[model samples]
Target: MAGHRNIGSAQSQSFSKAERLNSKKLMDELFNKGSSFVLYPFRVYWMKHEQPVPSKVQVLISVPKKNFPLAVDRNRIKRLMREAYRKNKFLIIDSMNGNEKNLAVAFLFTGKNLSPQNLTPNPSLKQRGMATQKKSSVKNLPQYKLVEEKMIEALNQLSKNSLK
Candidate 1:
């Protein structure tokens, strides 16, 4: 009998190491000189990487220490942001792919600090949905469709700026 192996869907959905913005100099430029747009809770900073790179885009997500005094809250917000970006990044990546350019981007979570109750799990959630996790709920996430739309708008803005 032939062996059955599990499909590597996690790898396909994962944010690989190569797609992370880890360079010090690049990050400095991305913050100091990059263009930004605010979509309520998410502030996106993005710039075309000056140096050539194989990856279409690299992303960094941050939830400020000032806003989230507890590490758990900060980490949870970051996890949600990453989940949103990983699932929706194709909107930007598809555009960049056609033009063959590399982009470095940072997404900062700017939402107000919530009371612990606001971050608690909702018992009614289904197991696997874009906006919820199995153990904990990503409460207060902008709807997945809205997040994707915002990403697309930001990328469109980036392209327009590039033309000028």
Candidate 2:
């Protein structure tokens, strides 16, 4: 992690336990005192940690039980969300390191469950001439990509307003 990172590459990506936010007290405070924003499928909530650390960030990802009644459905969604974050977090980590702050964030999946139609590539993707015809990994669905894009956008916005 000390050296340069390759953007958009999944080879070295990881979401280790150290980077997971699990404190009930911290989570409670984040909801009570943190700022929040809706990034479509996800509702993001974040707050700066009192003691800043070099790691830069710790995050919690959740899929609501209401939307996904079955445990398997919720687990699948959470897995995809976590994978997307693991691949996309370098953008935020570098920016946050520059600002020297530790941030705790929660991403709650709020969108309705993906129906059969939703699993198919978007019409806009087809219109844009993206290759939707070829078989792709089940993990490469458009919704998950959208989640990554929205997360990056939120991280950029957060970097601009980071604790100074």
Candidate 3:
């Protein structure tokens, strides 16, 4: 069973510690000097480093405490962001691999908590004259699909920018 395991598959999708941007000095430099662009839910900041590094790209994911007051909410958003990046990071990484410069990137969550707008009431409920109370719904939570889509787009955009 062990011998049959697909090592390439696991390694391709792995988000190792080396990929995380954790240095305070580097973080500050990235935020202060990096160029940025808004892609709806995320504001991406990226800078190319002249120095050589083992990892082609380092990423930092942030969910603002002000937008997500609860620790659980912030953590969930961050998790989603990280997962999205982990899955689609090859869009940027593969492009950067041959380049001499290393990249530092940060993905900041800019959108508010997602909640479905009840613009039109259900016809059946309206006809029955039942009150539509706003209860906590799964629709209000962040979605992986949306996050992954945005992450893919952001990585593509970053790769394009890096080429120039």
Candidate 4:
């Protein structure tokens, strides 16, 4: 049974408390000294951990109240971000496993409200007194598939950066 492995225990795709960045001090340091890059809907901040951490990678997901005024909307966005991260975190984990460095990352939601109704009218159209019509083909990307795709891309980018 040397080669046999339990599929269920092989990879835990769970977002555990241990993998959450919760320390105010560490968070302050990460914000103050971390390198950041914008990946469309997310502004990612990451720093190599100075202290030994239980997990190889820890993450914080933030949805700004300014962008999403409603609590429900913010919560939903956070949930989607969390789910996407939970499923794809192995991208970072596997990349970092060989290295001694532990990583702390923050994912800030930078996109405007995803709801079509909340979309702001074009300033030129507003100034010209032209009606702004919503396009039927343009749908909100609150769906899991779209969010997951972005998450995967972000993680892949971060992994590449971490290698440097």
Higher-ranked by TM-score: 1 or 3: 3
lDDT of 4 by residue, 19-41 (tens): 99988998999999999999878
| Model 1 misplacement above 4 A | 1-11, 113-164
Q: After superposition, how far is residue 38 of candidate 3 from its true place, in Å?
A: 0.5
Look at candidate 4 and tell me the lDDT of residue 154.
96
Candidate 3 on 1-164: residue-level lDDT in tens?
75352333234777889999888988999999999999988999999987555587999999887776667667877998999998788778778868888999999998875545412223664556553544312214467888888898999899999999
41-158 in candidate 1: lDDT tens per residue?
A: 6788888765865477888889887666657667866776777667656555655655645789888878763345434544455445534433233444334455455555665665
Model 3 residue 101 lDDT score: 89
Q: Candidate 4, after superposition: displacement of residue 156 in Å?
A: 0.1
**Model 3: lowest-lDDT 10 consecutive positions:** 131-140
Off by over 4 Å in 2: 1-5, 8-12, 52-54, 113-117, 120-143
Worst 10 residues of 1 by lDDT: 3-12
Better of 1 and 4 by TM-score: 4
Lowest summed lDDT across 10 adjacent residues in model 4 is found at: 132-141
Alpha-carbon TM-score of each model against the true structure: 0.67, 0.71, 0.78, 0.78
Ranking by TM-score: 3, 4, 2, 1
RMSD score of candidate 4 (Å) = 8.1
